[model samples]
Target: MIKKLLELSNLETTISLRQKELLELEEKIEEKKRLLKQLSRKVRKYEEYNVAEKEAAVTVAVEAEPDSEKKVGEIARTDLVRLLESGRVPQSVIESLKDKRYSKDTFDLNFPMLREVTDMGKVDELKKDQ
Candidate 1:
């Protein structure tokens, strides 16, 4: 009977050890789940922050320029004739000024005398008058 009691006690000790191991494993699993949840929350927050920053930058760029105007080219024959008849500019210069594709810099670079005849404001004034 004493031998039987000793055997039963050994069996109980083995079962107690197994139960402790199982409890430790369960605790480790719970800790991993908590850490995974925290990491997922951090990732989602960063994604939302990145999207908001990009949207704000785009909005700022669009709103920065409200009244910016583009410069358009204009050349009128009537203005060219008036400039020519005024005796301030030559006939050849007047003929060359008929084309609207040429800017003041381009015309002056091609024919220096054209620059002396019509002031830079002449083309702009003629466009406004028309």
Candidate 2:
């Protein structure tokens, strides 16, 4: 009976050791899962940050033109060239007409004209006429 008791005690000790090992393994797995979750969250935040930065860059690019009036003036200059090319106006007359119209304040003249032309609904009218 004493021998049987010793054997039973040894078996009980072995079972306890196995249970302790299992609990340790479970704790390790839980820690790993928590770490993975934290890493995933960080990755998601980085992705969102990148997306927002790209959107802001695109917005800035869309509105990057410094002076809208200057662009319009350049367009008008090109139109004048086209009109002269089409024989609507003679080349010899064009230079004299430009000198009279522009004078010393040539650069200043067009910005305000461009602004007024844009504000006065002239662009829509011109588009319709075309």
Index of the highest-TM-score prediction: 2
Tell me the TM-score of each prediction against the true structure: 0.47, 0.48
1-130 per-residue lDDT for model 1 (tens digits): 9999999999999999999999999999999999999999999998787666655543543344434352212222343334445675434344444544443454433322233326665765544422
RMSD of 2: 18.3
C-alpha lDDT values of all predictions: 0.56, 0.58
Task: Kindly give the stretch of ten consecutive residues in candidate 1 with the minimal lDDT sum.
Answer: 70-79
Candidate 2 lDDT tens digits, 16-41:
99999999999999999999999999
Give the residue spans of candidate 2 off by over 4 A: 66-130
